[model samples]
Target chain A: MGGLTVMQALAAKLPGERFLYLGDTARLPYGTKSADTVRRYALQAAHALTDHGVKLVVIACNTASVGLPYLQEALAPMPVIGVIEPGAAAALAVAPNGPIGVIATEGTVKGGAYVRAIHAHSTAPVVQQACPLFVPMAEEGLTDGPIAEAVAHRYLDPLMARLPKPKVLVLGCTHYPALKGVITRVVGPEVTLVDSAAITANAVERLLDEKGLRATEKPGEHHFYCTDAPDRFARVGEIFFGNPIDPGAVEQVDLQ
Target chain B: MGGLTVMQALAAKLPGERFLYLGDTARLPYGTKSADTVRRYALQAAHALTDHGVKLVVIACNTASVGLPYLQEALAPMPVIGVIEPGAAAALAVAPNGPIGVIATEGTVKGGAYVRAIHAHSTAPVVQQACPLFVPMAEEGLTDGPIAEAVAHRYLDPLMARLPKPKVLVLGCTHYPALKGVITRVVGPEVTLVDSAAITANAVERLLDEKGLRATEKPGEHHFYCTDAPDRFARVGEIFFGNPIDPGAVEQVDLQ
Candidate 1:
């Protein structure tokens, strides 16, 4: 899910920076696994990305973010930034005085990455809620309608009632933004919702610029790789990127 | 999480089935991955299960149920059933007219397996809510307490207000029964909450009996395998199974 959106944003923002988006289609969705399991899969993905000549790696998935410490250790030499810190930093910056709500996958919420990161920089309390179903819906392109609205209410109602009602809500997982509309409505118009992808993309842009790793040369060729059916990846990637990605651009890579 | 439940349930009901529970610890959360990705991981897990000489296979995860058609085709010749059909069947039988609420991972909700299954058998209204965070909480042993209660209230309150209220609430995911107490309290006592494992076990027992596949000798033994760290699996499994599961019994499987 993060694979699709991050690539879309990158294409729009850094038109000249070559991007390689790999979906571990064979073993996608690391959010439900244990921390150890997430770390292993993340390392494998990082290795593949690095081998593809990615100067900087973005751990777009929140589950992967929780294991960024392990990924950083393995993917050292290349600068690696996870979606959590950038997001946490952004949430804090936006609502320094109010509570911040973080919605993510079960694994990410349990790891307490956002909570810790948010708490580290500011005294603003962090309220973490894991909306596990959001990923599947986003992936399935079921982000709108009564079903989506019902789900948004089911997840956001309780979080909205908490003391002071969080002014800033963090879309912790990469797949979450797809459900942002329904989520925003459920949480109400007053609360500010944060999508990590946007923040993370901005952070990536800054990191690349500061480190002199920004690709300034070509028209930025984009490559999409999945561990499973390449065609399916392209189909789903197209939905995520909000544009038709050429099937030819998507190919399969053996994660095993 | 299902690993521990399988082990405990096996220890009690069918000890003769020598246990080998693979955690897929490496690729733990099959729920968030795409249908194609889930099918591939589930197939890998089934291979491990068949390799262990198990006559029957249970795709314990709810997400797998949405993709059961694919799994049924892949694990052919061997009788394999996912938690969805049995669970949906159970809910339908109890509440032919009453509304049904389903809680599951994001993937399961997106698949609409429960809704389709229920609609196919009965006219009962189905309200499927995705409690994406529940899996991680249960795995983290945050099954009870202020934090868990708060989380459950946040997720269930909206579902509670949905309609005339559901008579039966299906705990669509295997990890959900752990949160039953809080879920029941939040949703209210009027609704009967369903646990997929119990329903699946009942279904499994019936199938085994009908086919004369029940272990007629000693009790069945369960072996748990995860693709991640054994210690982490065992620790989380122990919390959910309500017993001290020997960490040594959990062997890590390599997805690569």
Candidate 2:
């Protein structure tokens, strides 16, 4: 579902580029599953996208971004961009010297993809917390309220309380953007919030320019695909997509 | 997984019954998925369980229970027991007269399984509320807190305030039991809370007894199987299982 947010960002940035977005709604919340399982699913998803004649693949999901190397290798000759690198770069650009905070799903935090990406550029003191409840809260439309606030406080207060308190906080999970209001309130105004969607979109544009694969057309059409529940995906997906999704337009594909 | 809760209740009620519990961790939270997708997944899971030489199949999940008829037909001759019927029956047993409040995931509530099941027995008015956040709250160990209370109040308060004022509140989803404390506080003491796990367990016992399939052994061994992340399942499953899950004992199997 968060991938919808990334797709929205990419559409906004590269208006000429046609987008074929795949939401594996059936085996979703990859953050809770194992790395091997996620990798296998990611490969399947990549293959689905490739089969559709997609020019480049964007691993919009933070958990799936951990398998960037595998996806890149498997989808070789076809460019693959993951959210972690762009998010890490954006966070470092904002706060290169000192502390950075990252909040994502358990799998992403445990995989340490953001941590590794951040370290690759600059050695910043990173404090990572896994706010597992945020996904459900975001999906349930509890993005703002007492429940959201309390949950945010519980997850963020600890990270913010650390020594040399984080100068920049990276919203590692795509769903985090939906809860941006509550997250912003909890993290306060001083800390910079890094959203991977916009940065990843920018990265995609740069990649297109470098590879000379940029579409020459003016405006491009967007097609949505999901492994299951195309109707529900189109309905609930509006939250992350930031646009109205025509239920009839969404196609159901079987990756298996 | 909520199925683990059903497994726990079954273990407690029928000590002599050998149990084979399968947690579809890879493609979980069937509540949010489409009916067709859930049915397909449920069939796959049922096939996996039947392949293990299990005598009977229990669709412990509330969402999956919507496909009980389909499963029963597919796995014919192998008796299938779904949680919805037993839970609805138990709710009716306590309050045979008027209103019943059913709280479950979106899929279950949308499917109207509990309502149909209850109406099948009596003319009781059923109000169903979908508490999408409870599953994550339970899994995240925020079962009893201000956050939990707020979420419960947000979900239950409306259902409780409806005309006729439900005399009984049914915890349709297995995960709801973990938040029983908060739910009790919200719904008040007058409303009797009905948990599907225990009721379903009793149904299983009665079915075994009637069919002469009850084991003669004194104590039965419990084997846990999951589609993915055996280690994480073992670690986090304690909240639902109410017992320490041995990581080494939990085998990972491929249902596909």
> What TM-score would every model get versus the actual structure?
0.67, 0.98
lDDT of each: 0.76, 0.91
| The TM-score obtained by chain A of candidate 2 when compared with the true chain A | 0.98
DockQ values of all predictions: 0.18, 0.86
For A101-155, candidate 2 gives per-residue lDDT tens digits of 9999999999999889988888788999999999988887888878889999999
For the second chain of model 1, what is the TM-score against the true structure's chain B?
0.92
Error of 1 at B2 (Å): 7.3
> What digit string (tens of lDDT, one per residue) describes model 1 on residues A121-219?
777877778786677667767688766786677678888889988999988888887887888788888888887767778888899899987777755
> Residue A182 error for model 1, in Å?
1.3
Q: Least accurate stretch of 10 residues (summed lDDT) in model 1 chain A? A: A1-10
Residue A39 alpha-carbon offset, candidate 1, angstroms: 1.7
Candidate 2, after superposition: displacement of residue B237 in Å?
Answer: 1.1
RMSD in Å for model 1: 7.3
Deviation in angstroms for B256 in model 1?
A: 3.7
